[model samples]
Target: MTKGEQTRRFIIKQSAELFNQHGYAGSSLSDITLATGIKKGGLYRHFASKDEIAVEAFNYACQIVGGKIEEAVQKGETSYDKLMAYFRVYEHAAESPPFIGGCPLLNTAVESDDSHPLLRSKAQESSGRTLDGIREIVEQGRASGEFRADVNAEALAMLTLSLLEGGIMLSRLEGSNRPMQLNIESYSSYLKQFCLK
Candidate 1:
């Protein structure tokens, strides 16, 4: 990559955690410069404004979390296992998240809601992708006769996402993993209910 491209990525890498932890409105230009060791002019050279940087930074944060989830899901032997593995990622992340902050999607969703339109949309899209992934796994399981036909894939997917994200929030706030582990166990039990007997 050219120097410009490298610098842009460096800014994103350094600012991702800042943006995720601080939110779009909370993070300032100074924070970006401080984190990246790049001046305001340099940041402006790469990003048009804080809004632009925030959108990109949020994408980077999501990529970090998504990569781990994809890895876990791929390692599963069955659809049910894959769905469970997805939650396991969050459980582990409660202890050691990909970045300093917890789930970026959750962070951005709460921060951007009715605040930053661009960021709010990005967070929404990220959530849709997550739900889509879960639904896909459920559909696969149903096709393979591993899950019951009566199961509502979309609803289950949304429930899984909500529980995982909510669990992360509670765990982070409480400074304990018990809440996260409990959420995972609860979801696992729920998943089993739909498993073919």
Candidate 2:
């Protein structure tokens, strides 16, 4: 890659955590400059504005978290195992989140809601992709006769995502992994209802 491209990536890598930890409005230009160790002029050279950088950083954060989820999902042989593996990735989110701050989708959705249109749109797209993936997994399980034929893949996928996100939020707020653990246990039990004996 060219030096300019490398520099832009470096800026995104460093600024990703900042944006994840602090919302677009909460994260100031000075904070980004400090995090990236790039002067304001240098930043402006790479990004047209802080909004552009924030968008890139949010994307970067999502990629990091998404990569981890993909890796875990790939390790499982069965659809149910794959779904469990996806949940396991966030089992210790309060202590060791996939990304620096937490789930990028959750953080961005909460912070960008009705405030930052661009970021809100990105979050919406990312979340839709996640739900689609989970739904696909459930559909596959049903096709394979692993899950019951009558399983509502869409509803189950939404429920899984909601439980996982809510677990992460509660665990982080309480500074413990108990909430996530409980969520995982509850979800696992619930998932069994859709399984074929």
Candidate 3:
């Protein structure tokens, strides 16, 4: 990649962690510069404004989720297993960074609101992609006869995200894993229902 592309990517990568951990509003350009060891002027060379960098950070955050989902489905014996495996993998990764932020989608949703127009759009787009992925997995399960044809794939996708994200929020706020594990168990039970013959 060109130097300009590399710098842009670096800025986004550094900012993703910062914005996810500290929030977009709380993260200043100086924090980014200090973390990256790049000067403020250097950061501006790649991003026009902090808002632009925030948008890019949101995309980077979304990409990590995309990669995790892709990895989770690699070894499933069947479509049903694949769907469940995706959630299970995410459950384990929940303690890891990014996910521990209680989901980039929820984070950005509450943080961006309608104020950060570009960041809000990024959050919306990322969520749409995640929903599409879950639906695709469910569609595959139906094709394999592992899931009922009557199931609402779209609704299930939304539910999966809701359970996981909501659980994370409660867990983070309480600074405990009890809430998270409870939601994981609940989510797994719902997945089991889909696996019924």
Candidate 4:
């Protein structure tokens, strides 16, 4: 890529980290320029406005989270293990600096719900992608005879998404991992009942 394109990506990358830590509303153009050490003109040269950058930043953050989940899925020992790892991925993310403001999708969903329709749509899309991943896993497990044949892939998808997102919110809000830990523990038992021999 050209240097200009590379610089734009770099700005987006850095801005995404900052935006994930601070809400889009809380992240000003000045904050973007300062965090990225790029002047406002330079930022505008790449992104039209802070809202544009915020949108890109949210996309970048979701990419980071999705990458981590994919890595976890690949590292597992079996279909069941991979499904187990999929759930474990969130607990791991909750501890990472990238999730310092908690799940980016959840943060943006709450922050942009009433203000920015586009941003809210992006957040919803991020969640839809993750739920798609969960659905695919459930389908795989069913095909492989790891999960029960009657497993409702879409229902499991929604449950997994709700449990993980809710666990993250509760754990972060309470400043403790107990909620997450307990939730994940329950997840393991649920897996045992549905997926294990």
Candidate 5:
């Protein structure tokens, strides 16, 4: 890549964790500059405004979380296993998140809900992608006779999404991994009862 492209990536890499941890309003230009070791002029050169940088940073954060889920899904041998693996990412979130903060999708969704329209939309799309991933796994499991044919893939996917994200939010709020760990175990149990023979 060109030097300019590399620099832009470097800026995003440096600023992603800051944004994820601080939220859009909380993370100031000074924080970004300090994290990136770039001056205000240099930041403006790469990004037109803080909003622009925030959008990119949010995307970067989401990509990090997505990468972990994707990695887990790839390691599973069956559709049921893959779905469980996806949820397992959250179980391990406190110990090994893709970034410093918790789930970026959840963080961005809550922080951007009323403040940044573009970011809110981005979070919505990210959520939709997550739901789609769960639905696909459920559908695949049913097709393979691993999950019950009577199960509603979309409904189950939505339920799984709610449980996992809610659990993560609670865990982060309470500053304990117990909530998420319980959710993971309960989710796995539900999966075994709902899908596996």
Candidate 6:
């Protein structure tokens, strides 16, 4: 890649944590500049505005998070194992989050719901994609006779995502992993109902 591209990526990489830790409105231009070690002029050269940089930073954060989940999911041979693997990715979120500030989707969704239209849209899109992925896994499991034929993939997927995200939120807020661990443990047992006899 060109030097310019590398610089842009570096900026995104640095700014991603800042954005994730601090909401878009909360993260000022000075914060971005400080995090990236780039002055106003240098930042403006790479990004047209803070909005553009925030969007890119959010996307970059999601990419890193998605990559980690995908890697874990790929290691499982069965759909149940795959779903469990996905949950396991965040098992220690409070202590060792996939990203520095926690789940970007959760953070962005909460912070941007009323204030940032663009970011809210981005979060919605990312959430939809995650739901779709989980739905696909459930469908595959049903097709393979691993899951019960009557399993409601859509609802199950939503529930799974909700449980995981909520768990992350609670865990992070309380500064402990108990909430996440409990959710994972309960979900694992609950998931057994979908298995074929």
Q: In model 4, what lDDT does residue 45 have?
A: 90
Q: Write candidate 4's Cα lDDT for 98-126 as tens digits.
A: 34566888889998999999999999898
Over 71-90, each residue of candidate 1 has an lDDT whose tens digit, in order, gives: 99999999988988877887
Tell me the spans in candidate 1 whose CA falls farther than 4 Å from its real position: none
Residue 185 accuracy (lDDT) in model 5 = 85
Candidate 3 vs 5: which has more TM-score: 5
Model 2 poorest 10 in a row by lDDT:
188-197
Local lDDT at 61 for model 2: 91
Q: For this target, which candidate reaches the highest TM-score against the unseen true structure?
A: 6
Candidate 3 to truth, TM: 0.88
Q: All candidates' TM-scores?
A: 0.96, 0.97, 0.88, 0.91, 0.95, 0.98
Residue 3 error, candidate 2, Å = 1.2
Total clashes in model 3, counting residue pairs 3 or more apart in sequence or in different chains:
0
For 1-197, candidate 5 gives per-residue lDDT tens digits of 99999999988877778878888888999999899889999999899998888888888888888998899999999987887776688775666655688888888899988888999999999999999999999898888888889989999899989998888888878778888888888888888887675
- For candidate 4, the TM-score is 0.91
- lDDT for 56 (candidate 1): 89
lDDT of each: 0.87, 0.89, 0.77, 0.80, 0.85, 0.92
lDDT tens digits, residue span 55-174, model 6: 999999999999999999999999998988777999998999999999999999999999999999999999999999999999999999899988899999999999999999999999
Clashing pairs in 2: none
Stretches of model 4 off by over 4 angstroms after superposition: 92-100, 195-197
Top-down lDDT ranking = 6, 2, 1, 5, 4, 3
